[model samples]
Target: MFTNIRKFSAVVVTSGAALALLSACGGTDSASMGGHDMSTMSSSAPAATAASAQPSATFNDADVMFAQMMIPHHQQAVEMAELADTRASDKEIKDLAAKIKAAQDPEIQTMQGWLTAWGKPMPSGGTDHGMGHDMLGMMSEEDMKKLADAKGAAFDKQFAQLMIAHHNGAIEMARTEQSQGSNPEAKDLAKTIEAAQQAEVEQMRKILKRL
Candidate 1:
């Protein structure tokens, strides 16, 4: 009887120890799960800064002035080119006007966009370039009216002369841009304008001689 009671006591002790070990294991698992939760908790993400967003092109005051002045200047050239129908009789003169319009119209838009992107004001429209001004070779109201009233050989001759002068003014402005402007794109455009207008000036001079 004593032997059976000793075996029963031993079995009870072993079961109690096993139960304690199971409870400890469960506690350890709960603590480990809580640590995982803590690891996941963090502050919200940061807001996007202006620098992180898209950047604007770099430019300077000279570039701004170039675009501002050139916009209106190109507009006038396009307008003069459009007057070829009533004011041009030479087939070459008419073709040249059309070409000028085609080139300058888009160039005007591009300059306007540059001003807007740079957060600058657009220039007011006018053709009253005074004597000794940088905006030389711009036609006066009287000059345009005279060309509009002429026809045949007179129209052809007047158009050639005025357009030649107009191109020279553009070349001067472009040279200023090329020399002092800060924007790479604007400078490149200025260079292109100088070359193309110089060529056109020569062509117009030749046309004038023929007329």
Candidate 2:
């Protein structure tokens, strides 16, 4: 009788264990069937957080200064180009001014975008950082007045001379940016400006000689 009792107890324990396992399996299946999607839960995670974990590009103070100063300097060039188009009598001079205006205006927009993205303010006119008075071939008030008042061959000659000086200044600024700027985009722009303005300088010199 005791042996039979022990056998019955073992059978009961095995049955209980099997029921527990069966309940666990049923719960898992219910979770799956009840639209509890583990895969979708993982897929819905924010990717921006993962992206934000990556390193950002670095820039130095010189890079900031270059962008700040050049924006205004390019603005001045565009102004001068507009003036030349209005006042210049020579077709070549007018065409050149128009081209300069076209090129620099887009570049100004690009630089402005950079400043905005970098959280820097647009350059103001009042501050003087000793970047020299001749930033990007800008003429003094007197020189601009002279250009405005001159006419015919005189205007053409003066425009060429002024433009050459202006292009040279742009090249100098671009070189500085190339040497000191840490931002890759700024450095690339500087290189482009250097190449383009250098070419313009040569063309202006030829125009001056012809005049």
Candidate 3:
């Protein structure tokens, strides 16, 4: 009877060891399953972020020049436009001035952003005519003085004529940029300036006839 009891005890101990081994194998499988899920989650997250992001556009040197030169050019136009607001008597002339200011101001900011991005200066300073006749389509000191001093219909007529010439000069510069400018943004802006200024030129000519 004692021998029989010993054999039964041995059978129970062996069964307990087998149960422990099965439990350890199950724990390892659970950890492996959790690790696999974590890896999948990590891999998918970056793809979601990339899908949501916006792609940036590229630019070149011609684009940079177009932005830089046009900023100051537009500034000068804005200044002239403001003068028309205060000094012009004709409603049409004032309207034209306002239009010029509205169009060029935003463009100036756009150019400044380009310059900042391009790591370039505001004006490259290759052309310097001072206050002389050499300046391209620029109003002389005397010309500005005349505009500042004129009154009523005379001021309106003169502003329209001078601005027509100014727009023409801008068109010429834009054409140069179109042909020679290396940057895409600059070339595109040049084309825009050419088209818009040409339209304004025709409008100014019509205004001159009415005046």
What is the lDDT of every predicted structure here? 0.60, 0.57, 0.55
For model 2, the superposed segments whose C-alpha errors exceed 4 Å read: 1-57, 125-131
Best by TM-score: 1
By descending TM-score, how would the candidates be arranged? Answer: 1, 2, 3
What tens-digit string does per-residue lDDT give for candidate 3 at 94-203? 98888887777666666666677667666533222132212235454566668878878999998987777667667766776666456565556667777777888888
Candidate 1: residue pairs that collide: none
What's the lDDT for residue 34 in model 1? 16
Worst 10 residues of 2 by lDDT: 36-45
Stretches of model 3 off by over 4 angstroms after superposition = 1-61, 124-135
Per-residue alpha-carbon lDDT of candidate 2 for residues 12-111, written as tens digits (9 for 90 to 100): 2343355456556763321111110100000001111121111235655445556666665666567667777667878988887887777776776676
Estimate, for each residue in 165-209, the C-alpha lDDT of model 1 and write its tens digit: 777777776776666566777776777777778888888999988
What TM-score, over all chains together, does every model reach? Answer: 0.70, 0.67, 0.66
lDDT of 3: 0.55
**Residue 8 in model 3: shift from native, Å?**
99
Which RMSD values do the candidates have, in order? 34.6, 30.2, 32.0
